[model samples]
Target chain A: MTPDIIYSGAGMVVFAMGLYGVIASAHILRKLVAINIMGIGVFMLLIATAHHDTLIDPVPHAMVLTGIVVAVAGTALCLWLAVVIRGLEHDAASHPSQ
Target chain B: MSPMLFVDGLLASGAIALALLSLNAREVFTSIVLFVCLGLLATLIWARLGAWDVAIAEAAIGAGLTGALLLAARHRLREPTSRDDTPAARRPHVS
Candidate 1:
């Protein structure tokens, strides 16, 4: 019963849940969240594996930090796009003639 | 059995539970809140794993910034008549 084993198993479950959400949800925002969850799961698994008895590896830590930054940027862009899309939808609804 | 392993187990389970609830919540707002919680729990997991760097990054960029961005977007979307309703084509260039 090591912490690594527990976190890795949990990561797999969370990743599966995220995959299911991405497949089942129609809303883009939900899909975005699902993607973030999936990313986190991958990060968890990576960090879980990087643990060593003697010394901790720095590469995975660096990678995860970069990943967090990239994820935030991607999420912000996705949210902007979603807002733009909703605005377009509202326009279409309001102006049925156009 | 070390007490630290016990804490790690709890955090792992808690994170998974939050992820499930976050994805399946009835409202997007609730889902967003749950997602933020998931991120925080994830931070704790990183700390337990001895990745202090990752823990701070997850807390600030992952949970804080992402949640704030999502909530702001949700606020904009919730407005019935958004100021952003002006169509792109209708707006004149600001040359």
Candidate 2:
């Protein structure tokens, strides 16, 4: 059993668990966290694939770096949207005529 | 098994366990904190998997920045409003 396969298998399990969280959780923030976890799982799998017995591949590493940045950006955007919507809901609920 | 292999397995399981715990945590704060720990574990796993660059990125962006963002958002989300936001209070609208 190679280390690469072990890591990738774990990654897949993580991804599945994240998927479950996203579906099962009702809270918007928790959904965002689950999505981030899913992204991390994918990055882990990519990292495993990049490693070799002789030479490590640079491409997957680069991909993971960029993916990390993008994932953070996406999460930030989602959080912003959620907060905004919450504010709107509060406002509407407080003043029904508005 | 070689020590290194066992270590890698340990790290992988740790990461997975953290993810699961964070997702299922009863409190939002607890879950967010656990997510940060997961990110740290993932950063170490990146290094163990021989991706030094990705490790740094995960530590800084994944763990550090993401944790900060989540904490801030959680704080904003928990702000008190004029009306109670609980499901029981809002049930009249659903019916």
Per-model chain A TM: 0.90, 0.97
The residue pairs found clashing in candidate 2 are none
Worst 10 residues of 1 chain A by lDDT: A49-58
Stretches off by above 4 angstroms in model 2 are: B82-95
Q: What number of backbone clashes does candidate 1 have, counting pairs of residues 3 or more apart or in separate chains?
A: 0
Candidate-wise lDDT, in order: 0.87, 0.88
lDDT of 1 by residue, B1-95 (tens): 67887788789989899999999999998998899999999998999888999999999989998988887877776767555546752343211
Pairs that collide in candidate 1 are: none
Tens-place lDDT digits, model 1, residues A1-98: 38889989999999999999999998777898999999999999989988876778889999999999998998999889887888888889998999
iRMSD value for model 1: 1.1
Q: Best DockQ goes to which candidate?
A: 1
